[model samples]
Target: MTALPLTEAARGATPTSSRVAAVTRLHLARRINVLVVPLIITAVVFVVTIVIQVAIQRATAGGSTAADYAAGARLNPAIAWAQTGYFVALGVSTVASTFPLAASLGTTRRDFALGTTLAHLLTSLYLTAVFTALLGLELLTDHWFGGFYVFDVGLLGAGDPATFAATIAVSSLLCLSIGSVFGAAWLRFGPRGPLAISLATVLVLAVVLLVAVPSFDALTTAFRPWWLVVGAAALIVLSVGGTFAFLRRASVR
Candidate 1:
């Protein structure tokens, strides 16, 4: 936020709900970073995707049929995840830059955590709604007037609006929560905090791979989408709780 007006409770006994709402407002005060930029990115990605695909369609017209072009579009699933990089960077900056200012405004750690999480929820919902709507339109138009696909591809729910919304919501919060934890780590323990987290994460992943590699086939066969949902849910909780734990113990610097 350019210049956050301190909205701390006056004194006596401010309700917990009010304090939390204040924090949420503080976080969302600067909507450009969390809101506008993503929309811009969407526009840019959409336009560029269409341009490149159209160019390819023209270039390969002699050899490839419409089926081939559609198949090729589905093959490039990476585009669906491209916005993830932006979200991750946004997540880190959101908490890292705001926490000290929030504390100076007399916002308690508990309030900050709750408020920031609410902001994350709202943001994820908003962005997901945008994408879901776009997906709906893409389906309605039969893949953008037929022969183009942006949100209707498999990587982005492939015309399934419910799955699309669910996927976007979870992924958005996952990105923000994960980044916020690292941001909180930096606030709590300085530069080494994120470093430590990185090392620990790497170690855990390595150990899991080592243990699971032997039964990888069996596990893969038995695995279900719900398992991934459960894992993601756990990770989201861990990240948010980690942020709170870090902020609770560390002084705002």
Candidate 2:
């Protein structure tokens, strides 16, 4: 039999749910750029970090005091921070590229938004699992190449596997949510809009910081893991809501 058009096929399927799944599968097919690229970057950075640590250790191998070794073994968690940029790019690209295609395929804005949200969440969880496994391996292998501290740094966990994984997972969601908002803004308002939104965000953050500086210590103390959880949830809700609202009115340009 001749194949039906995507819109007709979607109508004949399970309706909303299947449409969302179809949109999700469309994005998932491009998982290499969305997921693997960032992972490769993270892995490369991790390897470089270990190499640098090993070089430092080797330089002081002979007659190196315990304090020297300890100092040399210190690892910065900057590589993990770099991974967030990839996630942000992924979010922006999804909107810039996939939105138009989905619209062309007769996908409803609600289904597209839902599908993108689901894709990002699943991607975030998958990356979290991978990072967690890497951390475990790093720990088990005593830092994966001559006692390096790439994944065992204080910023990540200092040694606690659970804390490291939880931190990565939460931060990944926040980055993904923020990026999605940025993308949606761009999609709805065009180029200037996202820039304007970004500037406004910076201004608001600056104002908040200026107002809270006097109570910085107290604020930091009050900001606990539960607060992070709440904040992440709020961001995810707002980002997804904003995306849906924007795309609902957005034209395929």
C-alpha-based local distance difference test score of model 1: 0.82
In angstroms, how far off is 235's CA in candidate 2?
A: 2.1
Q: How well does candidate 1 match the true structure, expressed as C-alpha RMSD?
A: 2.6
Show pairs that collide, candidate 1: none
**What lDDT tens digits, residue by residue, belong to model 2 across residues 1-253?**
1121366555566567777777777777796886688778987887788678777777777878865675545558766778878888888777768888887777777888888888787778888888888788988886675677776777676768788888788777777777777888888888876898789879989999999999999998888667767877887787778778888777787
Q: RMSD of each candidate?
A: 2.6, 3.1
- The candidate maximizing TM-score is 1
List residue ranges in candidate 2 displaced over 4 A. 1-13, 59-75, 221-223
TM-score of model 2 (CA atoms): 0.87
Q: Model 1 misses residue 154 by how many Å?
A: 1.8
